[model samples]
Target: MLKLKSPQKATMQITRWVSDLDWRLLLLIIPSLSVLVFLSLSSTPIDSFPSLRSFIFNHTLLTSNSPDFVNSLPSGVHNRRESSVAKWKDELLRSRMAVCLVGGARRFELTGPSIVENILQVYPNADLFLHSPMDRNAYKFSLLKMAPRLASVRIFNPKPLNETESQVRVLTAANSPNGIQGLLQYFNLVEGCLQMIETYQKRKNFTYDWIIRTRVDGYWNAPLGPENFIPGQYLVPPGSDYGGLNDRLGIGDLNTSKVALARLSLIPKLDSAGFHQLNSETSFKAQLTTQHVPYLTKRVPFCIVTDRRYGFPPSRFGVPVAALSSPGPLSGAKCRPCTAACQGRCVAGVMRSLYKGWSWTDWDNGSLELCNARDQWERGWEKIFDKVAGKKSASVRKKFADLKKKECVDDFNEMKKRVSNWEAPPPEELCGLGLAV
Candidate 1:
């Protein structure tokens, strides 16, 4: 039998040999040997080669034995599956529809222009249903000619009735069947909206993917971005959640519409569910919660312009007086066109004092101002309007030219850009109380 050298002696001999060899040649030979050994080891089958199998098995044990491996793998799988499900649901819900219900006096005059110019124009794909107690003045909204489809415009001649009488009239007529008197009045409005969807769907042979419900007199301050649509959730403005969802804005799949439009009827379900004396907002919130419906709130860009007035130092019991000159296309809530007594620092202070949880968001850091335009429209409001209009209107074009000749072009342009980009400082910024974005 040939005698093999001991391990230590063998290693010493190899080291001495390497030390004597050309360094470059030794480096090349070492890497080449490493590659050959790796291939030979890898090619050996597990069962046939005990040493190689042991090496691989030890590596496998090291990796699989890690506590994090078991913990993380399941979590990764779950997240991936959840992501896939959400993607599928979003795609399925993309074809939904929206319904805008417009009722009340001066619906056209106060809100029609802005709706036509901003919302309806931008969202041409949306269906518009007008249910107003008609007045001859409704004719003034020829601009609404652009609506993709207009559902029935019911013109009920509302007799001057007290609050109780009006409520009863509205409720009874909304419930009536054929004579357009009771529940039918409300049903007509709801059905008219549904019919618009049905007509469009039948014409296209498809169902709408989503529906949005909003009031006619609600003026929009910003573009309604598509990001507002959340799957499996109805969305409304935050402050207006009045207990249920804000009856003002509702966005959901067809499944939600069936429950939401049964407004008067839902009251019984609410009362049956142990709800009592619920106000409009609260009742709306109850309907969703009781039905196990999910909902979300976003800051919708609108203001319900009201005409009610309250004294300064607004009594803890004082009603909030919103300015009509409130940089809005004023949808008819109620508004007074008077100069904001609460300007500059005072405006910032009042906005800060507002109950954020109940009223408005951080008031954009107090930059919001109420232009009480009831007593008088502000002096420079026309100029401000002209600046914002830019080349959109011929009148604005003329105004811009006159201002340019007066050497106010730079200042005007700066202000116009700020408004255009919505970069105006929040009320807090103007007051130097907080950082402005």
Candidate 2:
């Protein structure tokens, strides 16, 4: 098989091998040239390819339901939020609103101005109805003179309530330290304001489109917007459910509010429905549910400002009081001011341990700061509140703290002149409770 070939035959074979190698190389090069030509003709910029990939990657990262991602959203995302709020504001301008504020005015000096600016002034057409018990801190409410509209104001002395049989049977004294009498008084405060609204409506021959119920002790960091006004459903704040909807702040159409605000009148219905041992919030839910009323919840930008003390590093059943300066839409949770003992992972661990149906609030966004709250409000809290609440709000606080009895009486007189119904004690009695003789 190892036979030698002639020189001319070997030359011919080598040439054919060289020609086959060239054709194979051409086959590989032609496809690449075609691709390059196609790209060029399509006018695709070389830099644009990576940009397209980056855009998709960023969008996916942002849209994922990660808490961290949602908290630290991109700036463009904020623009979209601003746009939505603007739309909501426009709708609010068209609606007639009533704001019913209840509870004692313990910290109205700190809370009043913000309520005026963020709520009443924002809705200039809104009618404000105030129902509160007279107390040494009552003079602080003089700051409400800044409100754009005043419908009715009542500041009454605390009186012993005769708890009805139905109230005793339906309500629980377990969490209410003041017992059944406390529940009766609170129910009276809410329903009394509703009564004022009805009388005013009857006088004017026109009804409000919306009714808002909030607390006098509530400190609002932001304006209440129109998104809370659902046409068919009552709206309440999201957390501290206590086996029911949060009754600290509520908003609804007039029809829905009639059902929501009838606190005392609904007890008989609750009794018939076999609901018992219910706290305020639970009773509220029962009343609505039994009436076939629908409700929705959203996070509101306010806290139930408090001076009460709770234990530090709270137990599972204990309440976690937030710091006043904490950047939170506290949503009606109890709060006070102090150096924070918990945040981030510590907060998550503590919140997870607590009952969500009880004292829990939205703590994942780093918006909440915990306070030891083992003691009363610390010294120089005024300065701290002033710094965080801005100069305008601080000025309001200072004015009220320095309010004299005479000035307080004059302000009450002015408030009396403004309201259609002023069913309260005389200005002297109202202001004297707070002012030193």
Roughly what TM-score does model 2 have, to 2 decimal places?
0.81
What is candidate 2's lDDT per residue for 176-238, written digit by digit as tens? 869888888898999988998999999999999889998888888898765566665688888
TM-score for each prediction?
0.54, 0.81
* Candidate 2 CA-lDDT value: 0.78
Q: Where is the poorest 10-residue window by lDDT in model 2?
A: 54-63
Q: Write the per-residue lDDT of candidate 1 for residues 1-437, one digit (tens) a residue.
A: 21223322332344566557653465467665445445544534454343332223222222223345435446664465446445644553344455555454343334444455555655565555554444433332333444554433333444443323333432322212322243334434554555555555676676666677766656555555454555455667765332234556776666666565555555556656676544455656777787766565655555554433345544333224445435432222233334455555766666556544333322343434554433444565445534433334334234323332123323323333332122222222221221111
**Cα error, candidate 1, residue 158 (Å):** 4.6
Query: Candidate 2: RMSD over Cα atoms?
Result: 19.2
Evaluate residue 377 in candidate 2 and report its C-alpha lDDT on the 0 to 100 scale: 84
| Deviation of model 2 at 64, angstroms | 14
